[model samples]
Target: MFKLSSTVSQAPISINDSSPAAQASTRLIGFGQTCPQQGCGGASTTLKQLDTRINPDNMCSAGFNASTELCVYSTTSQTACYGDNWQRVGTCARR
Candidate 1:
């Protein structure tokens, strides 16, 4: 028999600091674990943001490329998407 448990931290994580570039707007979708059948165990965070768009920063052209983030499941070795193009950075795994 197998069981699964998940928990998300209420703390906020800071990303991309010390850069002179403009900060991008980001949003958190949700966090949880995959189905037990998949043997995934641990907590994961999801985030979504608009793809790079043309602005005064990069000129009047969509020269920025959109990227999607992914984090590997510790137990199941499964890949999960944060939101749409948001990538998973880390996992809050419980012993």
Candidate 2:
């Protein structure tokens, strides 16, 4: 068993005039591949990770992060290229 924790400060929500609320609501995506195990839910992606220089795969398991313009869930847990950070350095293959 393992425990992972982090202090993240989320930015305030902004009201946009570009689209409908329903459409924008569907865009606030979070989390990557989640596990039922304890303390294994902090999965995310960052813009730095999306850069090929940092991570080649540059993809997320869940979807995309619009605010940061970074791909989330690109990496998995308990792997070489992944850990608490869970950057998109790793690939999420789906067939």
Candidate 3:
């Protein structure tokens, strides 16, 4: 759990619940290290924002609930890895 400096301004993205996940586009902001494995604290400290969408799949196979959980993936190589918590930003309505 990382804490933001008091001097830094906090502008959190808003969640768009009115629209469906498939219809809405989003940019995921994550502070994750560019490493191969988990447990590596974001020491490399890479702040990335990847454009993605909700991926539809069986909950049993993907290990995520369609009703509650959201599964998104980036077409590029960058991704939100382990140790990257609270990384879900919000919908990109402006874009």
Candidate 4:
């Protein structure tokens, strides 16, 4: 199973990277995960699995993009991880 990772520790590309509605949605999750300094703007969860967040750092060969902030490939058992947990988005080998 591939794990998702977050770039929260690293400086965001820009202050405007996160949207207001996205931020609010994250607050709704409540206590499930830690929000970045700006709060969880791009976090999300789906029926396929648990309440996993979006990982902005895609450093795997799983061919998924964490920047999208969605549980990429999460619909299937493949489980494309991202965000909060600081896990890599794909099961690919990382350099």
What would the TM-scores of all predictions be?
0.18, 0.17, 0.55, 0.19
Candidate 2 residue lDDT tens string, 1-95: 85549755975455443322221112222334344444555554532122122222234444544344323232323321223222122232221
Per-residue lDDT for 1-95 in model 3, tens only? 88866665766645555434552565666565556576544544666666665555442244455555455665676666544432343322111
lDDT of 2: 0.32
Best by TM-score: 3
Q: Following a full C-alpha superposition, what root-mean-square deviation does model 2 have from the true structure?
A: 13.0
State the weakest 10-residue window (summed lDDT) of model 4: 22-31
Q: Lowest summed lDDT over 10 consecutive residues: which window, candidate 3?
A: 86-95
Report the C-alpha lDDT of model 4 over 1-95, residue by residue, as the tens digit. 75558545675333344433321222111112223333334445432233333323443347555554333222223322234231232222111
Which of the two, 1 or 3, has more TM-score?
Answer: 3
| Residue 40 accuracy (lDDT) in model 4 | 38
Candidate 3 Cα deviation (angstroms), residue 95: 25
**lDDT on C-alpha atoms for all candidate structures:** 0.32, 0.32, 0.51, 0.31
Q: Model 1 TM-score?
A: 0.18
Give the range of the ten consecutive residues with the poorest summed lDDT in model 1. Answer: 66-75
